[model samples]
Target chain A: DAGVTQSPTHLIKTRGQQVTLRCSPKSGHDTVSWYQQALGQGPQFIFQYYEEEERQRGNFPDRFSGHQFPNYSSELNVNALLLGDSALYLCASSLNGGVYGYTFGSGTRLTVV
Target chain B: GQQVMQIPQYQHVQEGEDFTTYCNSSTTLSNIQWYKQRPGGHPVFLIQLVKSGEVKKQKRLTFQFGEAKKNSSLHITATQTTDVGTYFCAGPYLSSNTGKLIFGQGTTLQVKP
Candidate 1:
């Protein structure tokens, strides 16, 4: 199993609602990044956090925002979610933003109805 | 804009057969990373290549980075049931190498024993 830990292995939500997903980095890790994986597609980078700050972001809108805590844990918040938002959310952790390769969590499956 | 692309979206191979997936990047990459995801599991880090014309091996799997640093490949010497999964290649954006990866579409491998 991946050393990283994530919460709410699965979730069902309605369109227009908001959702929050949490993640805890693996032991001794400090960088956390999030990805959204759609069915039959590759994972898409959302953003990355380092030292409790957002280091970089992807093409996603501001509605898909995230925060990293001092302990290297992170939260992904999506507002006004749409049906297209339904996908598997994956969390990966590493030292220096995956320069050493990333360790991923089981992921949270979000379904928007 | 940075992008990564993978070919042979799906491959079905018999046990003991060989398998290969190719990845290409829109821009030169400092390094390339490989990952594998099971049918219903999150992606797991497989390996990373840094130097040009570099190759690394792990048992039955072999990874190679191109001299141009814009292409890479993962080759399996002998496919096994346990090797069934989707393999992905990711690279940091050339504009911002702060650890945010631009992932490829990935290639799914189905190994029948």
Candidate 2:
């Protein structure tokens, strides 16, 4: 079976512009979470979506938002992008609340120039 | 805010040598999960430790959870080139909530043949 998949492996955006990243969860999975990882750093949780509703979010501001489709796919949208927003955006999927290990996608590398 | 810190941000070892990375949490955690990310690749699930003082082994890799649930460790015996990657530890901010995660900065390991 195919694992978690993300679209647009790489992207570039200018300041003040917006970007949308997409993810398809692994088969039989329901919950999807997003993370941001800067170069040489670990992934930081952005938010999680379940049942087509956002369940929990990290310390990120309103500029970062996401949505989950009925099919368990997800989209992470970053508005008013800044230089600091340049990073690898990861998408992970789990069966439930993620108590078990999470399956991650290769991630979308966003370059804010 | 909760945070996960990892030690020895980078490590280089010879083939057949051993290596270890420690992860600590500023707040108590309900469970800890480990993942490995190869160069230019996405993070892959390694293991998860839920109970206090829990220990789990995967071939040459051993994972441990502290008695207080505030610390964890990943030990690799006889390291190989395939082991060269960034290892991350993550846990939820709330013990009962598994939707969000606090990830360690990650330990980057390099193995020389």
Candidate 3:
């Protein structure tokens, strides 16, 4: 079985521009969550998507948004990116509410220039 | 806002030395999970603890959850070079069923062989 997969392992974006990162959850999983990991810090929750709707969100601002497709794939969009937006974006997936067995993707490294 | 804090942001140990990392949460948690991330790699699920005062062992690694469900710890016996990585403890926010996790700052372990 395939684990969570993320696209564009590494990306470079300029200030004021926007970037979209994609993720495909592991097979037999329906819930997807996004996290941002800055240098020398733990991953911070961004939001979670279940059944094509956002179920929970963290303290992030409106500049960060996400979408979940019917197939359980997800996309994280960051608008008006700043240099501080540079970080590793992680995608995790699990069954149901992830009471157990959560899988994480290698993550997309976003470099805001 | 719920927060998870970890101690000893970094640790360096001899190849055979033991290591441990502590995690504390500002609020009670229904369950807690652990993950390990190697250099230049994504975080991988290690284990999860649910019941208060629960303990689980995985080979040389032992995991414990506090009696109040607000703290947890990971202990590694006889560490090796392969154990060099950052260990994170995470738990869901109160009243959240969407699998959004609040992660600790993480303890980076460096084992010298």
Candidate 4:
């Protein structure tokens, strides 16, 4: 299996601009989760998608939103980005309703200038 | 919201030395998972512990879940260049159905030959 796949390995955006990151879940997986990792820090949970609906959210503001498609692929959309928003965005996928380990993508590096 | 805290944000050790990172959660967890991220790489799943007071090993790495399920740990028997990375412990939120993970801040290990 290809495991999780993310698009746009790196992105550079201006403050106040918006960015969208994409992720394709691993084969046979049905759940997708997004996380943000600042330099020298562990990933912070952003949200999780299952059955094309957001089932859980973190402490992040509503400016961070996401969507999961029918094929279990996912997208993370950040609106009105700030310099502090710059970080590595990670995507992880796991099987729903089962005890399964998560598969993570290489992640997209977002730099807000 | 739950919180996972890790200690000693960074560690520098000589090759062949042992190292350990600890993780504690604000609330009891049903399961705990560990991940390792090489510099400039995404987090990769290391192992998972589902039962309280359970321990598992992988080569030189040992993982343990607390008796109360409120904490966990990762121990490396011998340091190596390959073991130089950030280690993270994560657990699912108490009320999450989508299996969203709350990750600790992580402990970065630097191995010197």
* All candidates: TM-score: 0.97, 0.97, 0.97, 0.94
- In model 1, state the lDDT of residue B107: 97
Q: Return the clash pairs for model 2, or none.
A: none
DockQ for model 1 equals: 0.80
All-Cα superposition RMSD per candidate: 1.0, 1.2, 1.2, 1.6
Model 4 interface DockQ: 0.64
How much lDDT does candidate 1 score? 0.92
Range of the 10 consecutive residues with the lowest summed lDDT in candidate 3 chain B: B92-101
lDDT of 4 at B100: 70
Model 3 stretches with alpha carbons more than 4 Å out: B95-97
lDDT, candidate 1, A1-113, per-residue tens: 58899999999999999999999999999999999999989888899999988988888999999999989999999999999999999999998667788899999999999
Compared with the true structure, the alpha-carbon lDDT of candidate 3 equals 0.92
Worst 10 residues of 3 chain A by lDDT: A1-10
Evaluate all candidate structures by whole-model CA lDDT and list the values in order: 0.92, 0.93, 0.92, 0.89
Q: Candidate 4: give its CA RMSD in angstroms.
A: 1.6
lDDT of 3 by residue, B1-113 (tens): 78999998999999999999999999999889999999888889999898999999999999999999999999999999999999999998882544688889999999989
DockQ of each: 0.80, 0.86, 0.78, 0.64
How is the predicted docking of candidate 3 categorized under the CAPRI scheme?
A: medium
